[model samples]
Target chain A: MSNNNYVKNLIESGMRIDNRKFDEFREIEIKTNIIDRAEGSSIIKIGNTQIIVGVKLSVGEPFPDTPDEGILIVNAEFSPAASPSFEAGPPDENAIELARVVDRAIRESHCIDLKKLCIVPKEKVWNINIDIQVIDFDGNLIDAACMGTVAALKTTKIPKYENDEVDYEHREGELPLVDLPIYVTIYKIGDKLFVDPTKEEEEAADARISIATIQDGKICAIQKGGTGYFTISEIERAIEMSIIIGENLRNLFKH
Target chain B: MKEKEKLIINRKRLDGRDLYEMRKIEIQINPIKNSMGSAMFKFGKTWAIAATHGPRAAYPKWQQNPEFSILKTRYMMLPFSTWERSKPGISRRSIEISKVVNDALSNVIFLEDYPKTMIDVFIDIIEADASTRCAALNAASIALALAGVPLKDIVSSCSVGKIDGEIVLDIAGFEDNYGEVDCAVAMIPHEEKVLLLQMDGIVTKEEFKKMIMLAKEGCLKVYESQKTAIKQAFTNIIDIE
Candidate 1:
């Protein structure tokens, strides 16, 4: 309790243990096309938090609700080596939440233009599977995972499909993208809110909100987590912070 | 599927509601006699029942925490609840919804009061149309409150969607099938704080804010019905005495 109070007091007094500004994110480094065997892959590191995302394409049937659109499935795994809290088994709620949030951002934004992936409408559409792995333990996994997923998708190329057969030896054109979505998460410890929290800071935080925005400051997805609440003004501030940070992060992909 | 029928015509939904209107809601308390607390909440065509059990001993000893109690929420949709038969059993979708609903209520309940204990809330979707999660949350919150669990406030929930370039409240039926976006919100009304928020689909930032405002108003209305149901339940008990 005292440790929690100590962290909260410091944050409320306009200071972070890491000396970062309230809205500042840790140094981000995103590397794409990290795996040659995979169709697309990326490794992203925000401070000590590292995540890798790889995209795999397969032929499958589309869901009934979206018969004309291709299928997109996101799966995430937290390696036991990443953190002591994570176990070596199937995904728990945290892992599921991480994957779902990233999936919502990508799927909701219509970034992939799923229509183009459709080979035969409901019969034989290209199913895009994004697998995210947590390689290091830190905080701000959501932001890092989202960035890595986008990076991987940006570098993705469709596998050659001819005569109802996928040819691994051949390559097709680049993956069509409609818009780029970037996620920015803000953690609230006390009255103060900050971005890109470390593990220690995350432990002391009361609540956190993540917003995923597209190029024109449009919000595609949102999630509020933790056992604390945020007042109306706090939420508003978080949204503004998200938009500014998202724009800056989105700019990295232009190159 | 039928010639791309319009969802909204003449500024009104097919169900005869305005853009900012929600479905008629109904609440019933203690629907399950043997449970600690239980309630059924209905939003037009959608219905859900939630039951709360235990601040009793924690199970699986390792899962117990020494400092505070734990809250677990399980959300399920019956096979017959939807238009088509959904496979019976816990799916990934249910697991994710359970986690979010648990988070939405964990803050309100004073779990620290009962160390080494756990509270389990189970919600079953009895019928479906749209906004099922929102309905499930509304039922679960009332069940927790009725169970005599110490709480800061009751959580109310609703969903907002955009259809044909217009934002509408409490999507159902045709609007839900063709809506461009669906955003579900759960909040503490008096505190003006949101507890659970999940959204999918596309909307600009301005439209998003408008949806939040509309959701808050919708939740407030749900809160009124909840309060009334609780009062009626207590009154019935007094008459039984």
Candidate 2:
């Protein structure tokens, strides 16, 4: 089937190939503490697609531009084994895009208080690496990766350090660095927008937009993808929907 | 060094379980509502979740045997599951286990009942210990059962190994590293049929037989525990008096 025909059929049915409405999402399942070695880790399943996010922390010099603040690096990789289209070696455009979308959502929202991450001013600060891996590609990998990243961050705890020597005791006293920042992605297929597109919808999608919002209805980041275009009104509608979706997602992490 | 000498010297294990004992096993089913079936299985420090989806229609143009169903399995471990950071992906080890699990499950699933349909079983390991793969397979089986997938029988799995040259029922991280032999077995308790078996390291045929027998015994125990978990889950939904 040609790509154009696929899109036409999908829009006409008001459903993606997987039978999900444009506003509907593939079933989502989130599991935290899936990674024991990382400070925080989570796995998000959106339909058959799976993404695992792990957060690791290290003490390092802060970036020159933000010397007083800590650093947050988001790296995303799509394993060649995940799908036939993903090749080995450096990240492809899709993987890079996934990382940028997730990173922008979290970083732009200032999910973690960078100042708190700083321990010795410019000399040493916490470098939080959020690594996302696409384990399976059934569809909508970016949304799943972002959700897992936020959940992992929310569940993450930094160890208390005083004199560089490790102290296993007195663990609970140190608080987490920041509140949770949630991400919601909406895909435009035909004339409608879907909350979370499955793999099939993703393949047939004309355009996709992701919005990252903090708790107070503030928009932190926005990303637009695909060869398709959306009108200004469509963009506004997506942002409104994202806020509602983001708030509900935020509540999910609270539990 | 003599085998008996090695066994006598190492009296204490890392986690302190007895040689013949198994790790504490905790199984939770339907932790998530959206999936057809979902389960979290913990064996001591190791943890994993399994989600089952569909007897949904198979994709067009894929290999289809009209008389049987297709079972697809994916096993993955999160980077945080280990002491060292791991990249998220389907590693070779996980892929091998996926194949084994698919093979094991096919034996018990009444595939002919769901012709031209597909069942996708996904197992994600959140924490890692020595026997994560076996735990994943067991958890997947339980999740499938909870999902109410038609099956000839429910399956359970366990591992046994020779640690310090002594036959141990289940080997944790420390023991797994120093152990001389490792064997994992998946079985259908009611049928007393072994569906999958894997072993590594060195052991005589006699020892292999013993290890397999012990693993089967352990699998039976696991099966009973899984049954109890399933019953509890259903009872929780019964609108109890």
Number of the top-ranking candidate, with DockQ as the measure: 1
Docking class of 2: incorrect
Question: How well is each residue in B58-134 modelled by candidate 2, as lDDT tens digits?
Answer: 87637565887888888899999988878889754576567667777776788889888889898999998878877
Task: Return the number of clashes found in candidate 1.
Answer: 0
lDDT per residue, candidate 1, A38-105, as tens digits?
88999999999999999988889988777878889999999999999889999998999999999999
Pick the TM-score winner. 1
Runs in model 1 lying further than 4 Å from the true structure = A1-3, B1-3, B234-241
Among residues 3 or more apart in sequence or in different chains, the pairs in candidate 2 whose N, CA or C atoms overlap within 3 Å are A22-A194, A34-B126, A35-B80, A35-B81, A36-B80, A36-B81, A37-B80, A139-A199
In order, candidate lDDTs are 0.88, 0.73
Q: Which candidate is the best by lDDT?
A: 1
lDDT (tens digit, per residue) of candidate 1 on B1-241: 3467788899998889999988888787898987899989989889999999989889988889998999989999999998889999888888889988899999889999989999999999989898999999999988998999999889999999899889999989667778888888899976789888888877887888888888889989988888788778754321110
